[model samples]
Target chain A: MTKLLEVKDVVAGYGDGPAILNGASIDVQPGKVHCIIGPNGAGKSTLLKAICGMLKVRQGSVMFKGQNLKGKRPDQVLREGICFVPQERALFPKMTVRENLRMGGFSMTDKATLEKRIDEIEERFPILRERRDQHAGTMSGGQQQTLAMARTMILRPEIVMLDEPSLGLAPKIVQEVFDIMKVMTEDGITVLLVEQNALMGLKHADWGVVLDLGRTLFEGPAKEVLTDPRIQELYLGGQKAA
Target chain B: MSDLIQILILGLALGGVYALMGAGLSLVFGVMRIVNLAHPSLIMLGAYVAYWAFRLYGIDPLIILPVAMVILAATGVILYKLVFEREARSAKYSEMTVLLTFAFAMVFEGALATAFTNTQRVTSPAYATDAIFIADIFIPLGQLYAGIVSLVLIAGLALWLKYTRFGYAIRATTQNREAAELLGVNVNFVGLVSFAIGLALAGAAGALVSFVFSFYPSKHWEWIAILMSLVVLGGMGSILGTVVAAYTLSVVAAYVGFFFGATWSTLTFFVALFVVLLVRPQGLFGEKPELA
Candidate 1:
């Protein structure tokens, strides 16, 4: 598998603060679901943020498709085929669903191409078509999550970085979100997901990286990591796989 | 009665200019959460620009509106780059902007004082005192023209915000900055452009004010207080609210002037503002204040 993105010992933090991501590193392969699971404050979200240019990287580098993404702004990162869906509800709440979707393609200057992409997206996510004029904030949690995912897809990005896609979601909605990830990987898009739900994340992902206190504890096939006694004890409350 | 109709027309005309002034102030506050105390001074600058354009070039202040807008927009861009840009991303942004813009206002006021020397000035055209009577209600030509121009400009701004791509970016940034950035918006660019547009609106309003009222550099302090009251009554960051509050308060002030005296008319703005603050601190249409 070809490496789509490579992070090398990246040190990052908020201003004048201790490092949240202390020398953390990971390689994400193309067309694969790479999940990073960790306990609170383990810097899973911060790692994703560092790669996407939301947080400033103090040291090391983020390489994507042979280009160094170290100092590029978030919009520049999006232009370079990477889209980040933040943990918070990232929709412009007052804007209509269609407006939110159009804004997702903000980098695209060609109106024809943008409209075509929206049409394609609407066909796949029929709910988006049905509620194109409705405000995104009024939608249910699952529906909003789906819309958020669809909004990023408008750019046809090669890599999607999701920060806790299932955070604060119901179990059924969580399952729906994971299914969307499956759909993304099947469509030849690489996904780098930061998930707090370790068990579900590991089960659905092809590769898993266990993060503990800003350092990688284990990196391997998701099934192997899931079955590992140490990960089972630390993350899964010692619950063995059925 | 004809008397009530005349007062209503006068109130609306005054309200139109206030709307133009308050809109820009409200927008800057909405997008960046910055209370730009320098806003009225910027309007004063626009007035001065219009004053000079008419005084030197023999151009109508009405025709000079676009020229004033461009100059003020450029000034806004430079001001954002020089002063506000660095502090924008800091934790102390809101607090810092108040002091920074207050200082900017003082410097601007001082510069105008140096240039124009605090003498009261008015742009009196050939038709400055011209009036048209309709059904025994007399409307001054300057106020009528300024009122029409203000409404048109305000409508144009509203349409731009609703229809254009840049408008969408501005609205998105206003709604959620991080979300806008993540969705490939150049938020810094949006900030620069929005500030420019806000000041441009101020410029347009200032040009109109030059024809309608006598002004000097120091007049901005009083104007700032009145503009702030309008914005506060309308709710910070709400364009529709600002326009509504402007008309409502102008009419109220007009009635007070008719009933009591012109001096008491000026006092009405502060009285209404205080009552609103005590009863509904968020203003008429404002949402509950978000914890910063």
Candidate 2:
């Protein structure tokens, strides 16, 4: 299968900082959930930022839909059908749920289609509909996460890159988040996420890409990566203590 | 009772202009985090624009208000591109922008000084010095007109922000810039347009200032302190807070000037600033910063 998105030997970091992503590469398949898991400082989040054009790529390239994303601004990358949800969820705290969603589809000039997509997204996330007028910050963590996900869907983006969606959520909400990722793939959107919970992330993802020392250490079927002895020893608490 | 009513009327009028001055500064700072030290210079420039138009073409300062706004807004665009755009890319934007803007302010002051000299100029149309009296209270026409115009502009701005798509982009940018950018909002464009809008508002206030107060190019030095007081007291980036603070403080200044002395009225700003800092450093409407 052709990769929907490809990050080839990308090197990137914050301003004037040492490279966090050193030649990190990934091949994301269309309509599949790909979870990137690694130890702390593994450059998982930096890889996502580099692909989405938030961080400037110092070397290599990010190709989405066969188009080189070099020198593109974050908004331009978003306009080109890639959306990013940062760890903070990036919602306007003072704005209402509906307003935040409107802002999410800001690139869309056609008001009718924008409103239509918003309506459809609200229908999909019924809680968003219920609290449509409420401030985003006032919502529960689960609802806010749902809103963040729903906001990304306003563009009907081909690729959605999420950074740590389940960092601070309850276990039930974490399951709901993974469930949402499944729904996202079923909706024809590619899901790329950096997850801290390796076991949960791999269990729910179709493909697991293991990253360490700013490079891809392993990539395989999620179950295969999960069962790998080396991965188990290094990441999954050392061969189950056997 | 009649004396107090007159003072209140005069104070509200002054407050209206103060709102216009504070709103632009609040917006630029809120959106760009650029403490545009050139703000008072822009205001002074606006007054000069109106003064020149009126003096040369015999047009009323109020009549040339829109033209002055457009001219100043264009200047804002130039300033943004020439000075701010490059500096914004730096890691030390907050610190660098302050010094850059202050330098720009001095450049503007020197230019105006060379062109117009240090002589005081006032744009006094026929009605500027006249007053409309109602039930033993008098309202100065110049202050009233300036106040009315400021209120109207403030209302227009509020509606635009609440209703329009571009306005929503501005608000989103103001709230969370990185989030706005990630969501496909062109934050650079937002910054450019907002900076222009801010200067345009200052121009409007300046046109009115030409009618109500006497000013030279160096008058901005004094005006900056006043504008700063209004912006800080209102809460750094809150437009509504700035407007409310403007009206409230102007009224207090009027009462103080009447009861105590004019010099004490000017001193009230610092006193209020000091107290607010001691009590609520975030100002009236600013969110309390979350402690990590």
Candidate 3:
């Protein structure tokens, strides 16, 4: 019911480059899925980076549980219960699926706590437990996406930020992944999903925000944003929002 | 029989040093995706450090091995921060690392030559000559020590990479640098430490082998042939592969020396490498090649 994280007018970019995210803000509530959909180069991934401290926050603030997330590193943000999965295939190819999961909990020290968390994660993503000994790279693209999600869940975070989890996946596998996202939301894990696949993302999401050229163009209920013609014109390439 | 066994012992000991040197090369290539050509020079520099330790403090070459590793590790970190890191990140990739390390090696070789004469230096302590005989096999005590130390250090490094936090970070980055950074890994920090750790292994190898063999300024060029062969035969970037390759080469060289002539032993080593490469270009334990 309460706000878990607040990205208030956050401005950020890489190196000494120009700000890619300008005056962007979003609030994620507990047990909510906030999907950000936009065309490529719209600062969607950059927004996720700003929240997780991968990029420098040059203006405004990111508050997680009332703690300023501005200069904290990605691991520290993860320690504070926020885990991020980038748009890239982030799994370590040489390591087994189980090893990758344990790697997600690298910052976690307590053995019992890690074991308990792994038990919980493996239960949700049965594929991970089924192929625990399999190398992450050996799995199918869709399966690798599932394993990546399971890897983050091992961290036992309050929020999981995903950047285009459905990219490079088959239509059927994409549906399966969306089902996993739904399950994640039902389990009370807040998700901030950045997607280019708009319709499916909106249907699976509780809330939706459309970003365009480094700024928030629209925000509201998923259905409402889906019906917004301007959003459809911009992101759907002038096609009707399916 | 006695002559053959002595040759085998000598070959194995030398192979252990080759493995150590190859391990460092493999680590740098594995983690940073760069071939460090000057790694041999770093090894030479390490030998100098050991030579100094023995001459000045009378510390045994065995004792100086770890100390030289630490010093070389520091030097490696500084070099990575200064040259290799930025260049490797550029569009040039491995070529930049090769050029930088080659330059560094030249400087390293020049400095070593300047610091001491180019003549060979043999470091020996009071017990360096002691040997143990089991059945008909004779093993020089120093050679045995170097071999054991090499194995132990390699095992220690392997265990450290498997179990430690920094090890996980290194492994993660080696898998995917950009993604690892997104997960909050300090890529720069990991790169620095990995570079240092990799070079330190080379340094230790240099010190150990210098004690066993006569050390000279340009011996790195000689070792490069064997070292590169071991790496290519084992699969570059695989530490375990390097060990396996090293021993394989050692056995081949020993037998060649025993059966044919000692002069052709090095040629035999190169031949074995070529055969292996023809069969498996990726090396014996190489990772599956991704689409470049």
Highest DockQ against the true fold, candidate = 2
How do the residues B1-292 of candidate 3 rate in per-residue lDDT, one tens digit apiece?
Answer: 7887788788888778788888999888888877888889888888888888898898888888889999999999888887776765565688777776778778878888888879989788765688888888878887888888999999999899888778888888887876676565777788888999998998898788777778888788877788888988888788888999898788779888778888888886688678877888888888656678
**What lDDT does the true structure give each of the candidates?**
0.90, 0.90, 0.84
- lDDT by residue for model 1 over B58-135, one digit each (tens)? 899999999999999999999999988887889989899989889999999999999999999999887778999997
> Model 1, range A1-242, lDDT digits (tens) per residue?
67889998999998879999888989999988899988899999999889989889999989999999998899999999999998886998888999999999988999889999999989988999999999987898888899899888888899999988998899988998998888888888899988887888888888999887888878999999899998889988887876
Error of 3 at A134 (Å): 2.4
Error of 2 at B14 (Å): 0.8
lDDT of 3 by residue, A42-103 (tens): 89999998888878899999999999999987767877899889887588888888778777
Model 3: clashing residue pairs?
none
Candidate with the larger TM-score of 1 and 2: 2
| Tens digit per residue, CA lDDT, model 2, A50-86 | 8888889999988888999978999999989999998
- TM-scores of chain B, in order: 0.97, 0.97, 0.93
lDDT of 3 at B97: 75
Give the higher-lDDT candidate: 2 or 3.
2
By TM-score, the best candidate is 2
